[model samples]
Target chain A: MKRVLAVTAFTFRELIRSRLLFVWLISVIVLCGLDFLLSILSFGSTLQIFMDLGLAGMEISGLLVLLLGLAVTYTTEMDQKAIFLHLAKPLTRGEYLLGRILGFFLVNCLVVLGMGLVIVGLVVFLGGGTVPVLFYECVVFILLEMFVLTTLGLTYQMIATSMVGVVLYTFFTVFLGQCIGEVQWLLNQQLSHWVKVLLRVVYYILPNLEAFNLKDRLYDPNLVLGWAQWQDILLYAFSYSFVVFLIGWINLEKREFR
Target chain B: MERTAVVTDSPCAIQIRGLSKTYKTGFWFTPKVTHALKTVQLDVYENQAFGLMGLNGAGKTTLIKLVLGLLRPTAGSVAVLGGNISQRGVRQRIGYLPELPYFSKQHTGRELLGYFGSLHGLAGSALQHRVDEILDLVRMRSAAGLKVSGYSKGMLQRIGIGQALIGKPRLLICDEPMSGLDPVGYKEMRDIFIDLKKAGTTLFLNTHILDEVERVCDRVGILHEGVLKEVVPISKILESSVPVDYWIDVDGAEAAKLSGMPFQETVRNNGGVQVSGLVLAETLALLTARKAQVKGVRPLSSQVEAYFLKAIGAQAHLNRPIGGRRP
Candidate 1:
């Protein structure tokens, strides 16, 4: 347990020293700039458009940071052999993997919550409006989405032999995960038995990222953010993350660091 | 209370039996299995520097990885300090410095040591004190604040040794520890290894440099083509490799006078005759009788080169560079 925390602390310090915050700051600036530009260009209510884009900006930044973080740490841990320092210790491989996931999630939190704070702060001071409760809800859902993506991204890093492969696999998986709803839609329509079974298998295999994606439905009148919905979403995220984490652990166990 | 030291009765730091490693590469449909290490047998005794000499593709690194628990052996077993290498307590007392020691470039030397120390269950003042001590021991105290990326190769190697020593390990495993080091750096590292040996730390060095092995190792195991050819004590290697014949340069009349002597095999080149298999005292006595002016005496190392040639050239690889087939 002590060794696990030590690895976690070291990983966190490593990400910080890598100056990941610089990337976050730049992302936040670009996101805010785009929000400001789009809110003005669109003919809709400026406040509504800005708030909507700001919420999206939060998710985009979190996902972006998670993707970039996985790439950087993968190079460090695998390509540059930084993992030798960790694995050479008395720590187990599982503990090392968990520590890395937690550390990456923590950084994602910082970016997500940092961008959240920026959006909320800007809405309150600049836009002369009170922060809506829905924004915080969106942030929570975005964090949930990030939590699942973090495990999946790290798992991809564990399985991929190259940086380009890791990024492409994770990105395409994310795209496919979000399109699981479309697959379900196709399933509802007329389809062959084999096609239906394949789609169902893929649906169950890949995570439904859109479940935690609340930005699009923030303005929906019937959007449910009740305790029952919260319980289901949290359970799904934890379950998906655990499975991905297990896959990553298994892959890592079989890996030979030559 | 301190845990029971498992190494109390065991005389060997590392013990391997029929160890083999085959790496599966290429595509999934047609997997290619490359035998990195054949069923090889070797041991590294405690409190001695054991050098594993091999050519590039001779399974040196593969064996080291198996011992380090970074790779599972395809066959056989490896035990460190009388226990499996996977045992956490056992690993805590084993320090490893790889051939290409790449660290977190973002971390300073002190920070990197502290992180490694924390994993060994050290923290607060204990971690800091140990990091500082290691820094001083590796003579990197002044540059402890510099990020690892800014460090020179020598400095990186010093910090690598420092991290390995942070745990005060009973066994130190180094892969090519002195490769790429400058003369001064190499000398310093060799001196450090000697000091560690004096302190009773068992050292396992994987290297292809025979000269370094001859100088520092107490025992050497020659690995070639995944096979352990020989594990000889350093003293025995020196004795086996030492020259057996003596050559002398004498005046022409003196050489002619010495030609009939049973111990003298005369060399006609440069107006000097060669003497083979003559004891130094007897040759001097014979020279004194003949009124010979001794110009020079050269000791031939055909015996030593003979041993080396057999060990490395067993696979008919006399021309291959050290470590076997690596580019």
Candidate 2:
């Protein structure tokens, strides 16, 4: 436990100092800047503009966090041989993997939260009123979703060194996971019974990341989320993150330092 | 009451028996297993500076990795501090300094030590104390707060030693610890090893620096072709082992002519002829009988290298033929 905390602290400090963090923050600010400039044209309703701009910013920032997190982790330790110093001590592979995943997760969460706040501020200023309560709830879901994706991305980085592997795996887990249920239903309608069963199995195997995403629900009052649904999604996201970290831990355990 | 000095006989710091490691790589589905380490065994005592010498591709790094539990040996057992290295908690008592030390680019020397100290279960005031002590020991205290990215190669090496010493481990394993350092850096590392030994820390050092091995190590082991060929005390290697030629400054030409002694190899000189394999006592006896002025005798080791070469060549010749390969 002590080793975990020590490694986590060091990992967090490393994340903060990396150029990836600065680049991620600047990209979010740039998106917000472009959104503000677009809002001046009076193209749509204030809420419509705010929601569209905010969701886009959130998605882009999440992507930046994922790619940067993967790149920074894959190359830094390897190119520097810094991993040896840590492994040389009493630190276990499990503790080091956990520390890395949690550290990156926290950084991504903080970046997303900061962007969410900026979006809320822009909405209040444009609408000329206070931000809606649903915005806060949506922020929570967004935080949970980012946590899940970041953990999975970190696991991919540990298992595979290629950036392409991380990007491709993360894409399928996030975007394809959202469309899996629809794809399953479509496959059932078009294919034979056995193929439908296989497709359903495939759908169930994916992360179902769309379940935790509640951003669009903020504007649709009829699709309101109850506390039970929120709890379910939260539990699912946390468990998925835990499983990803477990895989990462096992992967690191089997790795030879050479 | 004063504690009784109970001497418990523990196994050597590292013991590997019949260890083997094979790495598979090929284009086909069926790969070829390259034998990186083959049936290698080594035992290093505590408080001894054991040097592992080998050329490239000799499995030196692989052996060290197995000892550190970084690599799983395909066969045999590795027991470190009386515990299986594959199991957890065995690493707490061992400190390793790798060949080329690297750090998290953002961490300063102090943070690196603190992290490693905490990893070894040191926390709070004790952890802080250890960090400070190690930093000062490696002479890195002044630059303790600078990020590691800005550190020079020598400074990085010093900080690497600091991290290894943070736990005050009973066993300190250093792999090529002086690889890229200048002469001064190398000397400083040697000094640190001496200090660690004084503190009763067992150091296992692996390097190709023959001179450094002679200066620091107590025992030296040579690794070749994934196997340990020889392990001898430093004293034996440093001393003249085989018969060496001696240069004796003696008296007159008449005295040299009078000497009908059997010198294995001889050369004529102005007064006294130079002879090979002449012991000091024999020379003194001859000089004393002749009542001639005798000077000092010097034993040369240049012939020792030739002897080693001949021995190695003879072994090679026995393996194959002079120019033909064994079918």
DockQ (C-alpha based) per candidate is: 0.64, 0.55
lDDT of 2 by residue, A194-233 (tens): 8888887777667786776666666776876788887898
Q: Pick by DockQ: which candidate is best?
A: 1
Model 1 chain B poorest ten-residue lDDT run:
B318-327
lDDT of each: 0.81, 0.73
DockQ of 1: 0.64
Off by over 4 Å in 2: A125-127, B1-10, B240-327
- CA lDDT, candidate 2, residue B67: 90
For model 1, state the Cα shift of residue B133 in Å.
0.9
Q: lDDT winner among the candidates?
A: 1
Put down candidate 1 lDDT per residue, B196-298, tens digits, no spaces. 8888899899987666776677877888889888887776766663324455667655556666665554455344544433366687688778787877776
Q: Which ten residues in a row have the lowest lDDT in candidate 2 chain B?
A: B318-327
